[model samples]
Target: MNNPYNLVRKYDIMLKDFQTISTSFLVKQLPTATLFVDMKLRVVYASDKLISLFCDEKVNFVGQSLFTIFPELDSKWETVLKECLTGKSSPMGVQSFTDAEGKEKFYEWSNASWYDSDENIIGAIIQINDISLAIESDVALDKANILLKQQSELSKIGIWEYDLQKKTVYWCAMTKTIHEVALDYVPDIDKAIDFYKKGHSRNAISMAVFEATDKGRPWSLKLQIVTAKGNEKWVLAAGKPIFEKGKIARIMGTFQDINEEVVAEIKTKDNAKLLKTLIDHLPLNVFIKDRDSKKILVNKSECDYLGVANANELIGKTDFDVYPFETAKLSRDEDLQILETLKPILGKESISVKKDGSETVFLSSKIPLLDEDGHATGIVGISLDISDLKQKEQELRNLINVTSLQNKKLINFAHIVSHNLRSHSANFSMLLDFLVHEKDEEEKVKIVNMLTQASDNLLETLENLNEVVTLSTNTQAKKEKVNLHTKISEIQQNLSEIIQNNKLKIINKVSQNIDIRIVPAYLDSILMNFITNGVKYKHPDREPQLEFSTEVIKDYTVLSISDNGIGIDLEKYGSKLFGMYKTFHTNKDSRGIGLYITKNQVEAMHGKIEVESELGEGTKFKVFFK
Candidate 1:
């Protein structure tokens, strides 16, 4: 052999040189950011891409050490490169570092040793790739998957898949929890269908699945189900068939727990039905309208007033459909105003004239209906029939007018009668004086005496008649604020002697603050008459007692005078108790003129008198002052 060792060495040297030249050219033509390094970790050749990534410009970096070009490279990279130079292994992995600009960068390196023709170890070749964007993308994808899982759990939504080919099913964690099953529980198509409730629910879900798998149709339904713990629940199940090569491959969808929402909706509907029933039976004419002023709801009373057979006849109808043109226009205008102002029009009197010339009066009220956001939606109206009341009020006014005219005429007649009686009494008295002066015989003297007594009685009657005329003429008495307590006290003082003589007990329980609108003189006279009557009608069995009190009822202040005395038999003499000169007692001072005059005084002041009495019980007289 000419020299076997020398030939082997020479061949190895030539192979190394050729490998260097070809690898350098290949590195320069690589697509990614790649570079080749020698056994000493020095850059042998670098691609245009690598130079642009690590260097500011395309400078000569062929002879520079890898660490010198990238000074921030750590010891982990050195160890990887040195082990790759052994030619026993090729290490490929990613490494990260902060570059000169303080930006994080990732490099994917594939390092291996180059060999000669004799298979001897040579320098290493490192293909470095800038994988920063790919690394960041992978990190973001992982975070997104974690967040989606969390959101699905919180929303009570679970994903599921059914594989037709494998005849198997997959349930996410939330799906298992919804079914009240163990996390590791495995399910099949048949088993999944069994979870649905019997009858309607099971049939619905079965049909849905059949359509989805057979016809590639999608289904979303709210159905009931029974859990592993035997609890009934409402769930929203949705699914779609996945097609592959024009054939159904699998079914994938979501499952959600919707029990609370469905139950709430059912309860709300029940409440609405109850409210409708209640409103329909109301007696007053109640109605609800939409924004367009069309009737949406009406009660039976409303239908009756509109001349409809039933409430259905008036549905979706406007006022113009039921009422005359003028009446409908006025009602519509009021509805529009309430809607615009969001205010209520309460207790408004409306008059509707019929075609036959009859009129009906109604007290109507309208209020604005608002939505949850406080925006006006429509109006609610109520009307009450007041025609009968109005008619009665008019009739009362007419009667009052007629009574007033008659009273005036009666007062004028009393004045004329009293004047004529007074003149006749004066002439008769003069004739009686002449007879007394002319009489001398016994029979003449006796006749003259009787005539003189008759004349005296006639004069007394005329004087009392004058008093009545004077009081009747003052029908229009001026009213002023009078304190009841003070007037009662003065009357008591004026009648103190009579009160003491009969040992009468007069209790003034009237409130000091009780004031009434009445003529001052009339109050004094009324109090004086009541007090005197209480003393005059003293009972023989016991001591006389009088109680005075007051109360305010509605618009009237009532003064009550009660007495424990000999009472009148109202059933026997009630009608004529207050008649002129009527007396119920045998007492010498028993005169019914007091009550008659008291009633006249009260009526003149626009007040009234009510009496309650029994045969043996006490009497209560209530004076109502307006």
Candidate 2:
């Protein structure tokens, strides 16, 4: 081992073997075109590929100068080659070139000084690689990636890559959009999972990742996640495991915005549930039948009506199973009419027999349920048992007829009584006149006064009866919009003389904007009667003060007339306050007809009259109108 001569000889043998092997591999089989040239730029070694490329069959290229081979190239190549000879390395670069025969080629080339056995720089080596197709393919791949990024953003689809080796996440531009995160946001595995909802979506994705990493599985799932902006979205997460060394090395997937689609699906399910709950709890018997006239749905009430234990028992059953053939046929005909006309059949009456063989009447409303294309898919029927309502309607009709007959008889009897009373009083007046002349002077004067009294009483009684008849007979008001303040002002002016004569002070507190629906003729009378009655019934102990005001309640406008007068002792005569010819006050002008007719007139205009009073204080009459 210490012998330098033997060491040198063994090293030389090994060096020669390496040279022979490397030279053969480079010259005959190396894919790259390589050449060696001396410091003077004359070719020393030329690979077969290089020689074939730069030299023609007629030219002996083994000793040819590189300048002659590429004479059209500039001095830049010489400078680079000379620099390589001086032990400077040339970086690889690509250039497009054309041969002398006008063919196009692309070359990636570099230069380095070749070494000999003595470790001294011998000459420069030139290496060239043809990358024409590779360059074109790289250009095409770049354009495709740009277009893909644009499309991903437009479609709201984001791509993500999970690197198992580095345990990091790559979020593409569209992934940022889906997450509503800033473009510059960086993500890790934990953070990405955190973006998913903290429950099912998170757990599912975690499991999916675990399965992919441990078992090399792929997964696609629709799930929900919370976004960076605090919005919740539905997304489709699909992952394909990329394997290296028989284990998952990466997972690539897509995140699609399925918010609209998922939300719509959720709403559809909610609506179906709501509809089911509503129909089941409703009291009305509801049923839906398909185009074949078979019941497809039934509510709880419909099931009970058909004597079935559950609603599902009635499914796919025809009405003939639940009712008589004739009745079922009639029902089917009505359903057909609804479908044919494509219109709802509202308030139709029909009868069916129950399981107990009892007849029941129904008021049914049916409509065709149409699909999106406007084709009728089925009929939805809603029915109510109207037996009791029909019975009550008949009773109401009979009562109305009886009341009408009685009213007519009462009117006739009143007219007859008036006629006989008028006739008798007329006879008494004539007789008294005859007797006044026939008797002596003293007797004649008494008889004449009696006759005049009889005549006056008869006329007063007739006039009151006429007023009552007129008030009672009219049912509807000849209505117009009557301003409360304007009418009150007009009534005050009309009764100005009496108001002044009686020392009555009228305070009209009603608003100018308060208006009511009332008969124009009746409005004046109503206000006048209230005022005159107030003035007439005023207690002698105080001055008559009348205040008119208006207030609005729910759905009604109220006009209140208050008086500080001798309010009637309501406990004594409240019931007769508005009674016919019932007078409680000692005032000579207190004809009970005034309040009675006021009541009738108020009612005819669809208004209500209510009074609040104290015996020695004041009476307030509030009229409520719509």
Candidate 3:
């Protein structure tokens, strides 16, 4: 090891006439890695950068053999140096060396022999450049370009560049495809602008391009274009200007086909509008509440009943916001129950006292709105004004003078009205909701027909109410001994279509010899309700099944109907299972009045009914007759 300046002076006496200090300074400050080696192939004067770049710091290599400092270099280094000493400069060549950390690096070096003023060859000054970083950058740039090209193709994005100096336009392959033009189709600025739709689309694109080209600003717009094949499509056009000498010189941009997205968004908005119109036109008071019991949406009927000018006034408000404390609390409690259980509280009669102490009766149904995961996210509530029905009932009671016969008829008529109205109202709400959101024209027509049928049934029920109120007291009430097996068979035949459609197996296990003492109509109504319920709630994964069996216990004859269907949770809904307008399942057809009406009819005939069920397993209804 030697001081670099002293070592250089000792090796080349030709440098004595030169400023040794300046020569040492120039070599040390050289940006490029350089070394002066003698004809012996030993390092005579090494620049500071060369030493730091390739030689160990603690072991000075100014006087060391070049081979000793970089032994990893191959024997070709000797030939390169020997040629340089003979006045034949060596062309640039690459050498590879492994560092202490086992990382391989590349260096480019060229050798030219140095001489004194007399032109005598003294030593070789080698210039070396580290090219590892540049090589890595080149590899990374290649990968990025490949990835960008792949993405542009997949996204149907076309790139374009307009060079102002050349007055030429360049379009990528995808851009040409988007234009529905041949690959070799030359495009000018005017032709490209003409591709956009003639009206708003052309104007928008022209303005965007103007701003980008004239003001050096970037612009992105969604516009329509008519392709060469005459098909109109939506596209996203974006442009940026490249400036030269502080003035716009070129414009580069992308054109992306987004027809599918734009079309879908427009259709969705149309559907939403139609749905809102349907909901607002519904006759019943309908409102939807979020999980927190705040109203998210309300129909016109709900807003009118709540004394609001419009539905928007009622949105995001809870019952407490408009109703009295007691009324709001009651409604909130029912909402909480349905939300917690994810079950429906249907056809529940509620009485709200107004400020003037007058009562407004409403038949309200609240159904839990569930997400895909079956978790309740909100509740859809429908309430019907039944104050007029209540008034008629009171008038009938007053006119009948509280007589036992008349009261009995009144009770029966009342039950009929309650059951029928609840069923019709619930069906209306469900059908209307489906009709609103349904996109298929055929399905919507079917729903409309169903609504017409429901309307007819409701009108028939109203007519029946008037007729029943005038029934004579002399009308005899009697129970006949009906063949149980024959009755079940007749009912099954009536439900033949349902049975066939659902693949329901109605196993009538009742013995033909068995007979039951019951009113014929009561038995038919009771059997029909149970049979339909079995079919309506059948498990989706299993074939529908219903088995009717009869037995005699003590002095009572019992008929049991069982089905493999989605059953009730007795622990949660057992108490309200038979209550009017109480539905525990998510079946769209459930009105919660069938069981209530069935139970009432059974009791009217001096019969008792019992239900045994488990969620997801099935349900069985046993009716006992004396």
TM-score of each: 0.54, 0.39, 0.53
lDDT by residue for model 1 over 193-252, one digit each (tens)?
999999999999999999998888999999999999999989999999999999999999
lDDT of 2 by residue, 388-440 (tens): 88888988986687578448646754875578587767878686667856848
Give stretches of model 1 more than 4 Å off: 1-23, 88-92, 96-107, 116-118, 130-137, 284-344, 350-626
Report the alpha-carbon TM-score of model 2 versus the true structure: 0.39
lDDT of each: 0.84, 0.84, 0.84
Model 3, span 263-345: residue lDDT tens: 99999999988988898888788889998889998988887777779777878888888788888898899889998887898
- When summed lDDT is taken over every stretch of 10 residues in candidate 1, the lowest stretch is 405-414
User: By TM-score, highest first, what's the ranking?
Assistant: 1, 3, 2
Q: How far in Å is the alpha carbon of 47 misplaced in model 3?
A: 2.4
Q: Of models 2 and 3, which has the larger TM-score?
A: 3
Give candidate 1's total backbone clashes: 0
> Candidate 3 overall Cα lDDT vs. reference?
0.84
